[model samples]
Target: MNEELNARLLELLARIEPLLPPEQAPIDWSRDVAAIWQRHALGGRLTAVAPRDGVRVEELVGIDHQKQALLDNTRAFLRGRPANHALLWGARGTGKSSLIRALLNDLGDEGLRLIQVDRHDLVGLPTLVQSLRGSDYRFVVYCDDLSFEGSDDAYKALKSVLDGTLTGPPDNVLLYATSNRRHLLPERMADNSDTRIEGGEIHHGDAVEEKISLSDRFGLWLSFYPFDQSTYLAACRHWVAHLGGRFDTDAEAAARRFALERGVRSGRAAWQFAISWVGRQ
Candidate 1:
């Protein structure tokens, strides 16, 4: 009876053992600890250093300086050097976010990772840092379409992550963000400033200035403006030529006509028009 009872107890314990928290290295005072842990869900997110196993971020168009600036930064990080947090700001659909991914794909090492933290997840910034603090891989915490508006408290968490008084972000980590608004707000208006004075609200102006300062925290700021008439036409020509005689007419005229009809001249608009033209065949 005693032997039978011991076997049953061992079987029960084995079933529950796998559910317990993983064992850590023997906690030793002499050992310098970095709290970095592998992100189990990284492959699922399509954000983190993408499992280069097979991910495709669309190729970015037209922004030459923007592309090189980003590539340079990522290269430095991969080489284990200091790199600045970046803010990619400007007109909508300028491929700010796409460029970030492409740069990572082009330069990131197995040791470096891209962890996308959504705007809604801003409150968890510190938690992310704590989790990543000890890891050897460099991290690019990416935020897309990030901005603060209408009493949003998430910015407070972000400000801390950007340049916290308690502790700077780990050398192994950096941040990259994309925003449509230069100030990331609604014309720099304040909740109470509108009621106080119309011509000049001193307090509101200061508040706007503060919001702008958050963007300034970025060491590298890359602005993507609307593409020009020639650039737009060039993009069309590039696409058409790349396709090798897809269109019979000269691309310059059609590109101009497309931009005029769309009422916008941007890299994204250029690509959209090009894709549409290609599909016509």
Candidate 2:
């Protein structure tokens, strides 16, 4: 009777085995230069971007100082030297994000990994950092167009990660973010309206402190400004030459008109003009 019961249990177990979930696959970290982490209802999802898809350093124009600063810092990091977390803050369409992508591709052989995290996913940073701690490849957790609003709790999560609790940032990882706002926080004139005076000394508002301190956490701050008309035109010329095309008098005038119409001369605006010209040809 005991042997019969045991046989019945074994049969039941075998029947349930195939229905159970399979073991999770190990992460293939070597697969890509950069990855986008998308948060889901269940957990997190990762999408890989091909290395060749990223822009090269030579392709960028009109931000030589900013570019060199980033390249030098990145090279120092890759050499196993101390490197600061970088913040690229400036105007829109000024190649802030491009420099990062280009640098990664430029130094691909050095095992640099770029993990792009969205503002919404900042809460998951601790988990992400832990997973990367033991990896052999160096990582730059990139946040592009990052900014926080007044009621954003995500900022707290990021603050904690950036502040580095006690253990500090993982040796193999760094945080690099680009933003149009220098402080990575939205500000209003009213935010400064409520200042306090303590011990006969006027102090700034809490809102100002909160916004500015986040940027201060970063050791390196690289600023990018909108390009001038000549810089923009030069960029257009560079792209034309690279694409094996010439900028005739009509085309040059048209490109200037395009910039004027846009009301902003920038690297991106220049590129758009170049691409449009190439299409016409």
Candidate 3:
């Protein structure tokens, strides 16, 4: 009876051995357009961004210069040359985040992978970076609409990753963040008022310095401002043309009315107008 039991245990062990290897396998990063990372108490999880749902790079308009600069920076990183962690800062509805997504789509085939890390999940930066380190692909750890509030210490992890790390940022990765505030914080008249007098000279408060320093960490700063009338209309025309020239009516006049009603002129506003315009016809 003892010999028969030992043989049965060995047979079960052999069947279970095959399943163990697969459980320990590394993540399959090759099959997706992008990954949205969320941290849990146990570990991090990645949700794939399907290619069908991704926006193409060419879909953007009226910001060709900004787009080209970002593309060039991305290309430099892809080639293993020196590159800077970039910050896209400017007004709302100006396509700051859209440009980054578009760049990722444009370069997805070249082994450029994008991992979107949420602003709240920034505390998990070390873990996220560790996972991407020594990987075969180049990664853009992106943070959209990143900002900080009063004494909000969440920016610390990102600050260290940006430039303060002892070993510096990982060679295989780069950070691309988009923010409405150039300083990554909303300025308050009170924060600046609390100044120190050192040797009878007034200096800014630590709180102000802390906010400014965070933005300083980024090596590349790209600004996106609101568009003018002609530029906004031009963008509308481009989008209309790309959508197979489907609009029978004058898209320019309609776009101008939309921009006026919205009280904002930006690439995002133009895209919104185009969508609504197309839907109506």
* Cα lDDT of model 3 by residue, 1-281, tens digit: 99999999999989877754233334577776588888765567667766444676667776778888899999999999999899999989888888888887789888899889998888888788877889889999999999888667889999998888788778989999999889988787666576555334365576568878989999899998899998888777766666655544577778888999999998878777777887776
lDDT of each: 0.69, 0.82, 0.82
**Native-referenced Cα lDDT, model 2:** 0.82
Q: In lDDT terms, how accurate is model 3?
A: 0.82
Candidate 1, pairs of clashing residues: 34-134, 35-134, 36-134, 36-135, 48-114, 49-114
Q: Residues 1-281, candidate 2: write the lDDT tens digits.
A: 99999999999989988865454454577766777766554456567767545578878899989888888888888889989899999999999988888888898778888888999888777777777887888989899899988778887767777774888778888899999988887877766666555335355476578778888888899999999978898989887777777888887998999998999999889888888887788
Ranking by TM-score: 2, 3, 1
Clash totals for all candidate models: 6, 0, 0
Residue 95 Cα positional deviation in candidate 2, in Å, after optimal superposition? 0.4
Over 4 Å off, model 1: 1-59, 189-206, 241-250
TM-score of each: 0.71, 0.84, 0.84
